[model samples]
Target chain A: MLEQYRICQTTGLRVFQSTENLIKANAVVAVIFLAIGGLFGLSIALTRWKAVHLLPADWFYLALTAHGLDVLVVWIVFFEIAVLYFASSVILGCRIATPRWAWAAFALMLIGALVTNVAVLMGNSSVMFTSYVPLKADPSFYVGIILFAVGTLIACFVFFGTLVIAKQEKTYEGSVPLVTFGATVAAIIAVFTLASGAIILIPTLLWSMGYISHIDTLMYRTVWWGFGHSSQQINVAAHISIWYLISAVVLGAKPLSEKVSRFAFLLYVLFLQLASAHHLLVDPGISSTWKVFNTSYAIYLAVLGSMIHGLTVPGQIEAAQRKKGYNNGMFEWLRKAPWGNPAFSGMFISLILFGFLGGISGVVMGVEQINLIIHNTIYVPGHFHATVVAGTTLAFMAVTYLLVPLIFRRALILPGWAKAQPYLFGLGVAGISVFMMGAGTLGVPRRHWDISQADAILPYDFPGAANLMMGLNGMSAILAALGGFMFIVVVVGSILFGKKIDASTEVPIAPPEDARVVGEYGNEDHPAIPGTIALVGVFFVSFILYYFVNWKYLAEVWPLR
Target chain B: MSVSPPQQKIWWNEPVPKSELIWVIIAFIWGLIMFFAMVWWHIYGEQNLSNESYRITAEDFSAKTEAMVEKYKVREESGYPVVHPPPGEDIYLIARLWQWWPILELEKGQSYRLHLSSLDWMHGFSLQPVNINVQVHPDYEMVLTITPDSAGEFGIICNEYCGIGHHLMLGRMYVVDERGN
Candidate 1:
């Protein structure tokens, strides 16, 4: 099996045949789920639109539950597993340890995902993602999630095993690549996240089966968010790693200061999971001290970590572009960047949108007082759509374009559509996020199948603006669905029907110009990243502006006595 | 045919540039500032949820809420309890599957202790237009004081996903003048 492994000509990284197969399998499954989840998403969006109100109440909740699980847990985690294999075995040139075990994990995950989906579709498990106890679902729903988490837990262990094997095999000298280190952080956090899920979910599963008498709702929320919000922390770490990887692969970008970058990753490991407490900020039975501690003091350290990455990713790209002599004025390097390449353009857009939309709103929503207004509103979803969909999903989609030629050994089928996919998806998602948040600020309730509440005993009305915003959210969802459709077509077509190529013989799918593939990570320390410095200033201004705007909004509400 | 990752020393722990350190420090300061600002708001500013919640059995709480509603029962409108207890009195609100009970009628500018609890699943007290929201869970009575600054009919929408009729879980709060219009 080791003999079957070959060096990727495009990336010059080792690719174990078995590991490649696993990665391909996981990536395909992820895409399938993305399609399924995207369909459910479109239905929910239309249903909430008030004008269209697509699905009836029962189907709406069912779709919403499926949408949450498939997209948030299944799709992203599957892709992250692929990413883990790629980062570990492939990047470090080590054969994946226990390939048989990896397959078992994959099988477990697939079966678990299907079981959960079937349960939801069967109409017994419309309990939604945060299946708060007492409002019980089918036992199989909890069991499915448990099985999936256990499978992922094993996959994470496999990833760690690959790292240890690489170390013992002496595949590379010194520390692992920054991207690998970041993945390691994600893997470590995933252990904690999965464990939390198991801790609460096992009992909940028992409760669903009448084995347990009761589960405390508050305790359930506390621990559930430990699983729920921290899952996104996994995304944060994984997607940010991809950010580093993309900049390097696409532009030969080196971090401005590798030590500073590593420190940020360290900060993530130390503090990121604590931000999960933001979910319980407005919950009863928790102390103000705990809420304040989690939301403010400790959480800020995590925010700092993200802020550092927000600066350094673009900083690295600017440094690389300047080295290539695009260093005229401030943003000439940005302007001259390969806008046509989906990989670079997509990653860059993910970074920017994630920062401005997701990052800003997240901090505001986490603030204890500020959260009172937006907690459980559509604003909550709005913030996450920016982070998860626009940020992580977009990054994953972008990387898939790169993975096609490198791993699948096939050219992208529709290069033009691939090029347009990022902008369309990003723009539409941005619209969805902005419009939803706008509606939420206007006091539009979330998770409502009918925003009009037409069948209610007593008729009440939302401001006309809320209706308009929901209508726009529907329109944006259509645009996003189109983008999602194009992506599926491109990915599926490329994999199954596009022109196959020997990547070694031919230049693999528009390799980065003057590919300055550095011999070592952090070896190419440049003198200046001045353009990045300017950009960070702009980001700071935006962050301050958004933060104050929320405060102003909060203040405008009737003063608390 | 060769497949080997290259030996590369000093991958991490490289010397940080002065500029990067400066930005990190600046971020830390900004964060510190925000943290302190929140503390100030919680303490002195007009943004504090009443720190007056107590754990209770869902049954016990609901029974107490029923007694309170019966005591303050001003009228029965549309098969729902409408209560207007005295000013500054403890006001009881029950969140069930699809409604917040006892349409509250409060006097404007008179502080009232608004006690909220859920009888079944979790619900959210999202007082719209005013835009104050809090999660109302079973087994805990969440108490928040409110003196309505502007008198009007404020709709209370359950923001938390309860069930199929979570959307229809709407309650109204009428804050009229002292004359009880």
Candidate 2:
């Protein structure tokens, strides 16, 4: 039993051996998938750039299908599973429940991912991620996805089981840690997301195998997005959890109000999944009332939840900084922050970009009327790249900087590169998001081999600016790929060849003195966080302006009803 | 803080920060406003998408489109019909594997009930230059009462990925002045 547990010297949390190994396995595999998916993404971006035109039409579609599966589904889900384990066992100082079952979950997920990749590469399953019915992929493709979803479902159970174990053993006092609570929210959302996946994909599998004669196309889209869009909701919950964890671990920041933050998470549990309706806003067979109600998340309660998080995350950070004597002015705390630390810089950047770009654009386009201009355009991808890539992916990348040192027990190799990685990647992805949105606004189609309409019998010439946007997007993707390569190298190199850490190894940064006392309330005084409030004020202004701008654009379009 | 258990035994009873409380109230109000704005748009905005749709077979939809084409096709553009249906009549646009068949001609400022459905896989009805888009799915006939505010030659691009040759799937619409240019 002694051998089953080891105390982490850096944070002093008791890490369960099985849990650590599971995290390592999941994280390493997640990175491998990121590399594969990133490569596919790069090729697709190049092909979209008319000047480059890197891949043939068939290959472009193939690359797109692979890219969506590997990145959107595989890479993010794998990483999220790791986060679940970490938040449960590692943070709670309890042994992971059913370690053997956890291992099986990992194996099943790995196999499923590989099978799907094989199916995609076989040149038959190029149905683009939605795989909307009549356009069938190989039977194996659906089988792989179903298996993967099942594995994820099992992992979510394991997380729940671990939570129960922590409670039974009385791992700590009071409620579970806020990070654990947030993780619980993510796990609950994941269960719902995977159930939706099963509901649709099982029939899709049958249809692909010719066991079913026909599948309703509109029905497939409506149900698939329950799986599709909600999967990103899982990302939102998981990444927000990471945002809290990073703020706590790196800056010793406490939630400004735990009640508010946790309530926001609860809102996610209740209403976030309704965002699936956002995709169907422009589709037929759905009522405007259903679309309006569901797309706004039952009166935008979920948006309110996000708004609360947006304020509290930075608010807590500001409060923490002020307590450390950076209270000279509203801007001093931010100006004097540890910008050189990749963990802090990456988290901050993720917060700002996700709010401004992802959060704002998502709400703007999700409007029932406004969706007509943006649905299925490259703008849709642009909006998500901001949310998933710049927002969730960047936050994930930020946490990895800390995870390497804490879990891997190795100093991050290439310190300078690690510091620069987030900024480089963030800038590149932001460019991709902005430029793609610009092109999309100019009526550029997504998932097309050629926006130039080169081979069309009746070609429509896009504005010169649209071509410029694609070229810029291609360049930005290359830059992001380089940043991604640096991250992989730093992480993998550290795991293999960097100096190993022991109990006596000196950690460069220390938590705030109060944080050293486990289970203690660190921010009892509740220092005023004027800086964060001002920042959030700016965010609100921008969001309002952008929302109205879209409404203005909608008014300009030809009248329709 | 988050990595550890709450300092208070019962965190729910903790006092809410005035600032956070204020912000939450503000956010909730904003959310309500955003929701009402969409509802407001449906009543006041002219560009709202109609929920008017019916379930029709692919074969049935094709037959209606072909009948309209035979009746109103004045010319052929690249093997597809250049259909000039009278204003206020129902116009049929069929989406298929790789094309949006039957080029449409309409007078400016005229309202027509436009019908869109796919004969095969799902497609996107992306009318460019004015840049309006809607999803086109098989067996679901989506109808829209559209009045072209600006008259010109407009292009319909399939934004949704149907398969390989998706980019080549283009259809045209010519909105002429009263003189019928």
Candidate 3:
């Protein structure tokens, strides 16, 4: 197996053929689901917009169910499996152990994904994403999810096996790369997430089959969100790792401080799981003490972890830029940086949007008192879209741009469109998040098919501003759909029809040569990059202002004594 | 660009950057402050949801809510009951499929302990205009002490997805002036 592994000539990294094949397979499936999920997302946005009302009631629910499963579960998890494999085998310069088991995992995932989607499309499981108890769906629905989670669990185990192989092989000298360490964090979280899913979904399957008489609603919500919210936490770790990997692989940027960064990852393992408490903040069964303790005490540590990543990722980039002699003014380094590279631009956009829109809003909404205002509103979706779509999905798209040329040995088709696609997509997603949050602030419900409620026995009308904001949401969704469409076209076209490149003599996409100068731990050799410091200051100010604004908004919500 | 693999360094024992370390410390301090602030708000904030909740069966709560509605039956309309309970008392609101039962009428500037429970599935007690949202779950009664500051008709929409008619699940609360008209 060691003899069969070959070095990727372009990047000079070891690539096991089985790992390469698995990466290609999972990434391709992930993209296909992204395309399908984006279609369902577009339909959902249109239906919720109220003016268009594209899908009928039943179809609206169906599309919503599919959109959640396809995007949130299938697309993200499949891509993450690819990331796990790459980080383990390729980055560690080790041949993947148990290639047969890896194949079995992939096949199980594929079958599970297809089974779940078919079940959803069959119109039997319109329980939406949470699938709260007593609103039972078909038995196939539970089976589909259980199978999918089991497959992902197997994949996570396979990832762990490869890590053991890498350790035995002594692929790297002192330590695994920071990106691999971050993926390890993600894989660990995935095991926890998948196990939580089994705990809830197995009994759920039994109940759907009448094996169990009743599934306690409160218990189901508490346990199920352990699975649901932790899945997003996995995304957070994975995408942040991608951010680090892209900065290193694309810009040759080094971690400003590896020790602090690794500590942040450690914080994620200990405290980030507490964020599942934010979902339960407004629930009746939970006590205030539990809610406050989990949401504030444990959750803020997780926020601290994100805040560290927020500062260091860009700080590393800025230091690298300055080292390249771009350090002239407050922003000379930033201005001179590579803006045309899709990978770099997409990642930078993801960082900014994730911090400002997603990160800030998340902390605000997680507050126990303020949560009463927006828990089940469109604001919930708004925050997650910022994190998941803007942060994770966009980051994934950015890396896929690199993975195409690097892993597929093909040059990207439509380079110009690829460069512009990130901006277009980022802008559209930003609009959707903002407009949705604005509408939610005006008391717009989240999962309602129509805000108008025109067909109700007693008709009701939302505020005119809500109507207008939703209309803007509709327009933004269209723009985002176009961007999504462009992404699919670019990636699929590149994979299918792009020109092949000779890796032996040429590397088309290249980073700055001396950018990856990671100094020793606690080394204070690098000068302070003033621009990053200033930018971080600005981020802090924005966070403070937004947080206070929410408190003020909560203050104004009819002073209840 | 020369494509070379990055040199692997000590993973766990890397030296920390002074600035990043400072930032981490500041972040930790900020998190602590935010935690304390949450404690402060829950204690002192006027907009806090009720901490006076207790567990109860769905059937028992429904029966109690029915008794209250019968005791304070102001009118009946369209197979639904409308109860106008007096101010400064325990107000019962039952959430069922596609409607919040017994539209409650109250007086402005008066606090009422509003007990909310679900009959079949989970529902969201979303009071619009006021912009207060809380989850209504079956088998557990949630108590919210609310004071209507303004005299107007506020809509109570079930924000949770209950079933096909979740959108239609609407209730109204009338906060009236001193005349109680």
Candidate 4:
């Protein structure tokens, strides 16, 4: 049993060999897919840019399909599986449950991703990620997705099993670590998400192969969103978990109120899935009542959950910094933070952009009536690129800087490039999100091969500014692609050839102290988080102003019922 | 503290911080306001999506649209019918693979029960300039009562991708004044 585990020199955690191997395998495959997806994303962006219409129509659609699947589903989910295993087994100090079965799951996911990519490249499955039925893709496309979903489902069970093993072995004291708890929440959401995938994709698969006669378009959309949007919900949970984990590791920060944080996660498990309604708000065959209720997630309790997290995460960091005597001014804690560390910089940028751009725009367009103005527009993609790419993807990239050293046991190569990577990627994605939203507000369509309407029988000219937005978006995509390339090169090169950590290796951050009873704060009632409070105050004010501005925009649109 | 197990044996009994508690309360109230605002908009706001939809066959919707085009046809432009339907009438619009068939002309400030559906695949009824977008599905008829408040030539672009030719899918809506200019 002792031989199965090696004590990590930096953190002093017992790392099981089997679990480490699985995480390494998953992370490596995820990076490979990220490279592929990032390339496709750059191509599509260039195609959309009227100044440089890169790909022809057919190839553009095919690239779109491949891009969405690879990045949104394959890359994120693979990394998440790695996250799930690490959170449950490593954090809890237990062996992974069924290591061989976990390997089988990995194999299935890898094969599935490859098959789907091949099918999409075969040119028949040019249907966008939604794959709305009656516009059928090749049968293998559906099969590949099903295989991937099943593998993910198995991985979720492995997570749960590891949790059970941790409990049975009495690995920890009272409660699981907050990061593991968050991962538990992610795993629970993943189970529901994958089940929804099976419920819709199986029938869609049968229909594609002529086994079933027809699938109602509305029904397909309704159920498919249960899979599609809920999958993003999973990303939210996982990434938020990483947020807490990164803050804790990098700054030794603890949540102000464990009860509040845990309750927030509980809210996500209960109400986040209802976000599927955001996609269907402007669609037919659903009632306004259903849309309002579901989109709001029962009076926006889920949003409240996010709001709480938004405050508490940075609040924790501020409190920690102040404890270290950086409380000279309101922004001193933030200014004194480890800006040179890619982990801290990446995570911080992600937090800011996700809240301001992604969170605000999401609520605005998610309003039932307001959806009519921006649904299916480039604004939709703009909103998600902020959340998924700038927010979640950047956070993931940030954590990689830490993980490569800890798990891969190799010094991160190109430290200079690594430090700058988050800014480049985050700013580029932010530009993409903001500009796309601007163009979409001017009524630019998303997923179109050309915005210029060059081949239209009766072309309608968009405003001159909309063309400029696409051009800017194209440039931003290139910047983001460059950042993505840096990440891939740094991560791959570090793992393959960078200096290995040994007894002589210099560990920058001090090893964390052993867990001990946390004493009450100096006040015992009010925590000194003035900086976080001030920041959150700014967030609330911006949220209110932006939200009402959208409502004002809604008021100007043509009256409808 | 998040990466390692909790230091407290019973963290459930940990004292809640005033800062976090206050923030949660504020957030909860804001959430309530956002929820009620949607409901308020439904009651008082002029703009809202209609819940009126029916299960429609593609062929049936297509035939109805053809009939409306034939009845309301004023002229032909670029091989498509230019339809000028009467105000407040139940007008049909067909969304197909590469076009929003039968370009529509209506008077500004007049309401129309615009019935929209697809013939072959799902498409988006994205009326530009005005920027009123809605999802159109095959086998489903969406009835939207819209009042075009401004006079202009509005473009209908398919935002939902149908195929390789999706970008070329264009339709037009001309909202003129009482002068019909």
Best by lDDT: 2
Task: Give lDDT tens digits, candidate 2, residues A1-561.
Answer: 443888887788999888999999999999999999999999999998888999999999999999999999999999999999999999999899888889889988999999999999999999988888788899999989988888999999999999999999999888998999999999999999898989999988988888889888778888898899999999999999999998888888878778999999999999999998988888888999999999999999999999999999998888878877788978898998888988888888999989999999999999999988898889989999999999888899899998888888999899999999999999999999999999989999888898778789889989999999999999999999998999999999999998988888948455648473222333455578788999999999999999999999999999997
Q: What is the C-alpha RMSD of each candidate to the true structure, in Å?
A: 2.4, 1.5, 2.0, 1.5
Instruction: State model 3's lDDT.
Output: 0.85
DockQ pick, better of 3 and 4:
4
Model 2: fnat (fraction of native contacts): 0.90
Better of 3 and 4 by TM-score: 4
Candidates ranked, most accurate by lDDT first: 2, 4, 1, 3
Q: Tens digits of per-residue lDDT for model 4 on A1-561?
A: 443987787777778999999999999999999999999999999999988999999999999999999999999999999999999988888999998889999999999999899999999999888899988999999999998998998999999999999999998778898899999999999999888889999999999999999898888898999999999989888999999988887887777777889999999999999999999988988999999999999999889989999998998888777766687978898999999999999999999999999999999899998998999999999999999999889999998898898889999899999999999998899999999999999999989888788779878999999999999999999999999999999999999998999746848454344122123443543347788899899999999999999899989999998
| Span of 10 residues, lowest total lDDT, candidate 2 chain A | A514-523
Kindly provide the TM-score of model 3 when superposed on the true structure, using C-alpha atoms: 0.97
Candidate 4, CAPRI quality class derived from DockQ: high
| Reference-based lDDT, each prediction | 0.86, 0.90, 0.85, 0.90
- Candidate 1: stretches off by over 4 Å: A1-3, A297-299, A503-505, A508-527, B1-8, B11-13
Worst lDDT window (10 residues) for model 1 chain A?
Answer: A516-525
Better of 1 and 4 by TM-score: 4
Off by over 4 Å in 2: A1-3, A512-524
* Candidate 3 residue-wise lDDT, B32-109, digit = tens: 888888889877898876666677888899889989988988887666677778887899998999898888888888
